[model samples]
Target: MKYQIRHRTHYRYTQPLRSAVQTLCLTPRHTDTQHVHHWQLQSPTPLQPQTDAWGNHSHVLAVGAGARMLQCEATGMVETLGTPLQSDPLGPDPRLYLMPSALARADDALRRSALAAVRGVEGRQAQALALTALVAECVRYQPGRTNANTTAAEAWLGGVGVCQDQAHVLVAACRAVGLPARYVSGYFHARGGPELASHAWAQVCLDPAERRWLGLDVTHGCVVDERHVQIAVGPDYAACAPVRGVRSGGGGEQLTVSVEIIPQD
Candidate 1:
């Protein structure tokens, strides 16, 4: 499947930024399973986009005017090649170590929740899919409610989180249960779907016959379809991001983001 995306962002400042520095994570990344056919960003100032120390492509834009309007527009097409391997119980990949924080409590509420979802599932693939269903049934995929800083504990307890938060919790829970899991930031075009909103999910690697990374969207409670566009994969949230940056322009006083994702039928 091929998907075309159009994204627009507008920022209205309460006060003229004096001088502002803004970081953008709006760029859709291209990968083996994804391609960027066309892309653009329209801003009030020139964009000094560069690969950051972290190696993710970043957009660093500075506004000369104190108060100004910032707009970002981007369009691209990506294809899902279907993963080379999915749900491999025993692949050549190394074992994934879990973070202590992600598994701090052996009987934490969230761990219990994930276990309940896969009680009867013997293999990692089936268990991961079951957990995805649990998350989707447990929470709603609403944006603007949570952010990158939102804690996994809060999201799990609240039963509500944006895509990022949900992915974080799902991955953490998987790790907590001795499964190797990573976070994925990408775009998902549902079946006969519109260009998808900014989306994130998790991939778990369980040893046995299933060493392949299996994609699961707890936020949507479904396995990946053609709509999934993977940007990067990493052990945690900070890694595998499309874009990230620092603010040298006096913190910018304020910031806002607007994104419009449309899929070409």
Candidate 2:
């Protein structure tokens, strides 16, 4: 299937910004599940872009005019394809090793929630997958219910969040239980079921015990397959944002955003 995507993000500040810096992880990477045929980004400001350590395309955009909006508009054409056995999964294993920054964020609630998910599982590996399902059952997928700072324990407590929040909760839960997990920002193809939305999910590595990486969307209650299109993997959302920035020269500014994802027939 082919898709055309249009995304616009705008920012308005109370005061004019002399300069602005931003990181953009909006480009999709071709994987076992998807391919990017064409993509482009139009920024109101010029940028210095680089790929982050976590594999996200990063950017630093500067603002010269102090009174206009800061915006990013992008369009792309992509194809969702099938996975092949010869292809390897992206990122590191979770069951093997997880860093302190990643694991330290877990609280009692996160641990308990994740543990509860695996309590009924028969196998360790399958336990992780079950945990994913538990999270989906626990939280409602409603965008604008939470923000980036909203943690796993918070979302678990609230029982709702968007894809990013869902991934955060699951990542925190997985890491708290000694699983090596990372955050993933990407696109998903829903086919005839639903329209596409900018999506976020989680991945775990099995380390030496099992040489495999698994992708899970707690919000969707399923493992990522050919319909999934991944863009970045990191310890958190800060590592893989479609567009992030601050402006100093703009004041009393109004902002609007629109994101559309549709399947091409």
Which has the greatest lDDT?
A: 2
Per model, how many backbone clashes are there?
17, 12
lDDT for each residue of candidate 1 in 1-265, tens digit (9 for 90 to 100)? 6666666666655555456566765565554445677667676778887654323455777767555455566566666666623443222342543553431222388888877777878887777777777767776677677767676677777778788877877777777777777777777665655445667888777553434567887766666666677655555566554434432233333444444445565
RMSD of each: 5.0, 3.3
lDDT of 2 by residue, 217-242 (tens): 77667777766777777888776677
* Superposition-based RMSD of candidate 2 using all C-alpha atoms, in angstroms: 3.3
- The candidate that achieves the highest TM-score relative to the unseen native structure: 2
Candidate 2, residue 9: the lDDT equals 81
Q: In candidate 1, what residue range of length 10 has the lowest lDDT sum?
A: 88-97
